[model samples]
Target chain A: MITLTLLLISLLNGGLAALIFFRGLKNKANFFFFLTLVATFFWIFGLGMFRMSSFENGIYWATLFYISASFCITYFLYFALFFDNKNIGKINFLNHLLIHSPNIITIIILLANFHFIKDYSLEPWGKSIKLGPAYFFYVTHIVSYMGYAIFAIIKRFRNVSGIEKTQLKFIVFGTITASIFALAFNLFLPFYTYQFVWIGPYSLIIMVVAITYAITKHHLMGIKTITSEILVGLLLSILFVNIFFNDNNLWFKIIIFLVAILIGYFLIRSVFKEVRQREHIEKLMKMRSEFLDIASHQLKTPISVIMGTASMFREGSIGKLPKEQQKKFVENIYRKSVKLSGIVRDILSASEFDTEKFSLPEGRLEPVDLEKLLIKIKDDSKEEADEKGLELNFIKTRAKISPIISDEFYLTQAIANIVDNAIKYTKAGRIDIMLDEDEKEVIVKVKDTGVGIPNEDKSRMFGKFERARNARDMYTDGSGLGLFISKEIIDAHSEASIKFNSEENKGTEFIITFQT
Target chain B: MAKILLIEDDNDQILLYHTVFKMNGFNIISAIDGKIGLDRAKNEHPDLIILDLNMEEMSGEEVIKRLKKNPETKNIPVIILTNMDKRKFQSQMLELGAEYFWEKTVVMPPDVVKKVRDFLEKNKIK
Candidate 1:
């Protein structure tokens, strides 16, 4: 009964460790967890050997398993610390070595055949070891290490909320239950009575089951796909084991093995593909909701302006006797309507990028005059810059610049977006829109003496709906899709590229280059 | 006539509010940005200030915080007229001692004048 139970515990722990390690190979927490379970597996299996061995050999097996127990407790502590994606570098190497010093010293004493265990005596029920001077050391080591693991988890539990809090909750419950029972049955109870030593190993099942539940239910390590994958793998392994034990001929066995291998490969592949698709769909849903949030705010402003101005005209509330005032109100409505349409067009253009079959629309490509296009952008952005009391300059090249074959509408929109961003971010300094060219390329550089992009924000600047922290604080109304849409539009044009150089609190320069 | 300060960066919004307030027989002074708005609030001593949140040089929140901190401009009621989500800023604005937090898109210019008129009457600010 003892042998079979130990074998079951070892198998269970080994399987779990393998599954978690394989699925989350890159995660430090998973790696430490793998070590913890492997240590537990070794300790339990060693305990079984200690039970079956003779008096002399029983002492050796006892010492070996005690060493494994020490490692098991230490690894459990490491796993708890590393869990929740905490970076390993946070605990420096010297501190790590300091943490494991006691374990290391205990391992050395056990290996050197010190007075850790005085003797081993065989009895009717089981074999047990007599306590030595180092026995107190071993007991203290196990109790304190296990206690600290639980304590660390409880400490982390207070700082977290939501899913992480729940994840930590299960870990705390499992580790505390398993540690208490294991200490009572395996560590303390064994000193007084040997009858319940086996119960300590069985208590580990509670820990395993709790963590497995957490993994399958919560997004612990982002491996919720582990459940089905492990099931399919276990089922296939059982089929392979059954084939090996069959009374079939050698050739029959070989053929069955080949077919099983082929089936298993495709089954796992399909499961992986399905999980990936589900994750992708989930990401799209999150993006759509975020889009709607910003869309409502941006779209509402212009609509509000149009509706408010138009309503005042309609109601004639203050008695509109002056024709000049009426004309101004009419113009405001027209301007706001045009602004509303422009916002809607930007949103539509941004959504088009989400579709898989998206490409620049045909027949929209035409030879666009660089000078004419740029002057229009300057004229359009002048009112906004002038309102902020900043000079907007368009410096034309001395040499005549030729036009490029491109989508005239999108190209203009992309360039205009850059200039608009410049005006938005800048407070006082002048924005210089300089057009220059060489034999290979035509370049338009929009430079501003505004608050420049931070180093951390530069890489993700062109990502959809991603705004820098400073930018978000500075301007609350930006949808953060301007640069993303601009990049896409520029990339759509063959041999065209957009790049920028920015220094925080200094300025930013965006250069768009086109093939002549 | 109550001297009203309109602190908005948008020209069209400024125009709409300016014309409405003028027609309603209120003396309206306008500032193009938050910095100018703060200066006007302290210097002009307007009875009520209509502030826009997002601006280039300074923000409306900063303006309000400064106004409430200074003795000269602290008593004047500030009305936040913004295109931002009202739910996110309504409580925050009120906590900062703003008299009213109104979404620009939701309230008409005439409605804003009436709100201002009602607030001035209730507060007994001449």
Candidate 2:
């Protein structure tokens, strides 16, 4: 009876190991599944050897059992490492070696027992039988291996997450129940009896519960439902044959095989259909964003022209008119044009960028002197800067020319935008443009003693259509496209990157770095 | 006084521009559309061409290309006066050899006249 039970347990363990090993191949990173397979294989081997008629030899049976205990402890250690997400190098290698060392030592000791006792005897109980240890060392090895597994489990319990935690709990309870049953059987029976012979099957039942949770919830070891469904369909077809044919014939088997093949083909087709539907939805979303961008770009050009011309008219550079009349006309144009222009530009730029079609054209790049460019830009902006009563200063750090190869017009436009933004935001403080060059890159820093960007707004400062909350509340007239355009131009330049550091109520500094 | 040809489509805008240029002592000749403007350029042989980009019959770009192709009118400098933003239109017009590019909103009529005067002075046209 003992031999029959051992044979059945070994076959069950081998089947479970094979299933886990197949699943492990799908997600190569799943070390947990691989470790489980290792544990199951060892248990199958040890039990199969012990139940063999040739292993009625006492020492051989003891060695196999000891090897099985060692593998169990190794499997628990693997579970701990998988959950922690810690570097494998960080796990103490010496501790792992120490844990597995006892199995080999136990096998050696059990072999030595052959000198003392040649054969083992089976003691009988109620409907089951237990093997007695002829060697003393075999008893010590079993106790030590169990103790090590319990210690590793306690150490790992705190680190696991979600379903793994529940699985660990079940495993611990099952192990304890098995250990208690073993103790009870040994105390009640005469001779050195194998305690808790029923514990092996009960432990497997607990593992199956954990495995079921892992498959349904965590998808552990990548054991997906598709494979299980196929297995179930095969089993159901077999059952149908037995019921319909009472006494089985060749014709019944052929009918079941043909139906199973048809079902399998449809299941594969449905999975492909689901994938195609998901791709179609993604494509529609992409097209919608592109349409919006094109519309915005089309609207922006005319609005900018209207605003720019109005500002020029208000300045009275065209002809001499009465002072009072000119002032009133200028003020009206400025107020209305600025507001409308800001809205149009912001919306358009945001939409264009979203569509991902706003790309800079490749231009001939040549070395440009930073100081000369700054002087020209300063001259151009002087009138507007003076009108606001704000001082715009260009402070040159180097006497020599700091040259960078980039698209001259676009680079000038980028720098001009930053300067314009500073003047617009600052009320009375100075705006400074500083140029410096290092060994490999040229740096242009635009510093302003203006209403600095607040911390909350800093994160979204470069985002499309986003303005600082304070700027919005103050009713500042800005399209909020200057920085966005500047960023795009700089990013397109092979040698340039733009960054800034700002503090609330203090000031903001924008730094542009270009590869020399 | 310089004999300037102004090609524009909008009635109100053309009236305003005509009045402003007339007041500045320019001999203003007008065309309501690109076809008439091209006809006037061939017959009158104006000293300068003031072109509007957004027109109903023919676009400013198309007009400029046609004028550049004609040997008789190729020497006459074209000035782009449009309601389109400077950043978008300026670079393209400049590359096409437009002597001046002005955004009508940011540039008043007076500034346009001054720019024309400067161009004439630089080229020694008068």
TM-scores of chain A across candidates? 0.66, 0.41
Best by lDDT: 1
Q: Compute the lDDT of residue A57 as modeled in candidate 2.
A: 55
TM-score of each: 0.66, 0.35
Query: Best-fitting candidate, measured by DockQ?
Result: 1
Kindly list the per-residue Cα lDDT of model 2 for residues A1-516, writing each as its tens digit. 454444445444444544454333443224554565456445544554454434345345545544554555455445444433334444477876775566556555545653323434554532223334533444554455445545655666776778778756765665456444443442233234444533454345345445544455554422333464446444544543343344467676677656754664465345435544666677757644543443343343344434544534655533465577456545544544654554455455556666784555555677777788988888767766787788999987777756777667767777887888787777787899998877887888999987889876898787554579766543323445678777887887776799899987678899999887
Question: Over the stretch B47-102, how does candidate 1's per-residue lDDT look in tens digits?
Answer: 99999887756888999999999999999989999887788888999999998899
So what's the TM-score on candidate 2? 0.35
lDDT against the true structure, per candidate, is 0.81, 0.63
Worst 10 residues of 2 chain A by lDDT: A182-191
lDDT of 2 at A281: 70
